[model samples]
Target: MHHTTPPNTQLPFAQACENNQAPILAVLQTALQSSRHVLEIGSGTGQHSVYFAPRLPQLTWQTSDLTDNHPGIQAWHAAQTAPNLRAPLEFDLATSAWPTPADQPGFDAVFTSNTCHIVAWPLVQRMFELVGTHLPASGVFAIYGPFNYGGRFTSDSNQAFDAWLRQRDARSGLRDFEAVVALAKLHGMQLQRDEAMPANNRTLVFRKSLSQ
Candidate 1:
């Protein structure tokens, strides 16, 4: 049998999480200024959610991912003491029933980091679509990851990374920023900012435009 599964560590750690969290939080501070409720998709390892929730006391941070990731996420949630940080919700954007937030108007922000390239393209489309449905007017969506522009790689390193990802899983690789923005537009979201992040990554912020 082939070893297809990633190693299981109780407190599963990710160096990328530690390195990028501070920078990402800084951007979130400004992006989510008026926001209250935030739904974080692909809350892998529960690291980013736990790290960010306490700092942003004004917003309630919700963490969610596939069922297999729940135990590790719960471990992190248990360790954290912030009241605003919520327990992980077992969710799949493409397959889930499209659950709405408990509050009336819906979530004010949705955040996902380093997820698009790993999932299949159809699911990536679904993520953009479903985020549109969950967000209230003026809601913010912040996606952090490396992406190609004009269908060209930003750096040779990103090119290499993309190749490695595809070798690991044929469907996995960097997505074009233009294509992603087009998808966001179709769902009533408008690009508000595109800030460069460390390690050649970017944090793209979009705000919901439809009012109804």
Candidate 2:
């Protein structure tokens, strides 16, 4: 999830994905205990979908990302296919029209890692907007990445990372946790957990309001 590789890699890989998948899975096993289906946004190289689907055998894992990332994802899927893991869907938060509730009503949980800091802010808002619209009452949404708190970085490493990200794209940098929670609130979601992750990262979990 740190970088997007070219499609022609035949078998794209990300060490960060490998290092973090286990810890992420441990958190997910509990967070998504009752979830029967999950929609994975930004499936980068598809490493997470493959790793998570087989382990969380109770749920069907739906992978999605921009079309350019599909070949790498498909290649990974071909190498380690899971019956519960569906193929990747072409999804772009900035441009793709999200599936209607009738078309994707069964997705009870959503997951995305290392995406918020890379995409522009408006797209990030779109992601929460679509998730808020599509997710049913009590649906679970989990996002993993470095986030700022109270308008400040959590650690020097995160500060440096944010600098690096901004250097690459002026619009892309770590987001404020408060702003994220506020956005989620607008979408009828409430924060359920804020877990500390390795390498100065965090995993935030939100639950859609039942009143929705």
Candidate 3:
């Protein structure tokens, strides 16, 4: 059977996305079995949502980021047709009110990639608090990015990357893994899995507990 491929859509591409998507997918396939609605924070190029939505048709993927990122997200969403993929929306973690309705029961899972180090420390705290407020009890929250452990950089390359990030913005450097776990704990989530990824990055999964 002859098949015609769709023209490639030129949405902004993150090089790391190309390298890490497959491994991330492998982890997600296992972690997301019980999730029906996933809200992806900082959907950057929207590649992850587009890639995963089709593979896991059982889950509805909601992509969001700062308002500026919506265009690229829309472009990628438009290029593909998936019933489970919703249109991108504005979701600033630091804000008090999200664009989505307040009465909503919140997502079954929340996912973010390569965003923590790029945002300020306070925003990271806010992100976790918002996840606690917006996710149901026992819902999962997953973060994928480079992180420090025990006050040390994981690799020489991550050290250099940290230096580069600090040069751009003094606050824009990797965060400590333990600190993140502590933050999650304060907000009623427990660290579930910490999977090491290619190029010194890690995916941390946290599950909201019933106590909170």
lDDT ranking of the models = 2, 1, 3
**Residue-level lDDT tens digits of model 3 in 57-161:** 878898888888788788888887688888777888777464463534468899999889999999998888888877788899999999999999989999999
lDDT tens per residue, model 2, 1-212: 34545466658888788889988998899999999889999999889999999999999899999999998889899999899888888889989886433444478899999999999999999999999998889999999999999999999999999999999999999999999999999999999999988898999999999998
Pairs that collide, model 2 = none
**Model 2, poorest ten-residue lDDT window?**
97-106
In candidate 2, residue 65 scores what lDDT? 92
lDDT of 3: 0.86
lDDT of 1 by residue, 101-151 (tens): 565346789999989998889989999889887788888999999999999
Alpha-carbon error at 125 in model 3, in Å?
0.5
TM-score of each: 0.92, 0.93, 0.92
Each prediction's whole-model lDDT (CA): 0.87, 0.90, 0.86
**Cα lDDT for residue 76, model 3?**
81
Question: Which regions in candidate 2 have their CA more than 4 angstroms from the true location?
Answer: 1-9, 100-105
Output the better candidate (1/3) by lDDT.
Answer: 1
At residue 51, give the lDDT of candidate 1: 93
